[model samples]
Target: MNATAALHLIQAPVALCLDDEINIDLSATDPDGDELVYELTTPLHGANDIDPTAITPPPFTTIVWETGYSETYPIDSEPLFK
Candidate 1:
């Protein structure tokens, strides 16, 4: 799927605090194809809930940390294959 399509798959809250983590789920299928793979592209900085590589700023001292969670699963499809 394209970038626009990928964005649609992710459902993040509009108003999130600095420490809040967003969760997104992406699931796709190809009607006439097989071996579909789901790709989740996020900003390198915003991707990790608490990036150890990130240098905390002074203002971050008062901010609380939150974890973002997401999950994806095959909904309904034809010709169920194991």
Candidate 2:
């Protein structure tokens, strides 16, 4: 279980009303030839929802893990709050 896998965002400015999809790419060859599996240890939120005091913005961390694995990316919607 390595934690060096880099996570990226495919889309930005995710909306608060709609659910978003995120991709996690984890294609790598280990020296010991270990099969790699990607799992989200923690929740990733959009820039808007990060700060709670910002007038209750829409949900920004709804990640739907797809099949397969290398670089983890996120699909963001439009911003609900200002």
Best by TM-score: 1
- The runs of at least 3 residues in candidate 1 whose Cα sits more than 4 Å from the true structure, single-residue gaps closed, are 1-10, 38-82
TM-score of each: 0.28, 0.23
lDDT of candidate 2 over 5-73, digit per residue (tens): 433434444453446544344355555555667564435544355676554366656444565421343
Q: Worst 10-residue stretch by lDDT in candidate 1?
A: 69-78
TM-score for candidate 1: 0.28
Error of 2 at 29 (Å): 1.3
Lowest lDDT 10-mer window, candidate 2? 73-82
**CA RMSD, predictions in order:** 12.9, 12.6
**Candidate 1 residues 1-82, lDDT tens each?**
4333222365667786664555555566555555666553332332245675667554433322234422222222233311
Residue 46 local lDDT, model 1 = 27
Candidate with maximal lDDT:
2
Give lDDT for model 2. 0.46
lDDT of 2 at 16: 39
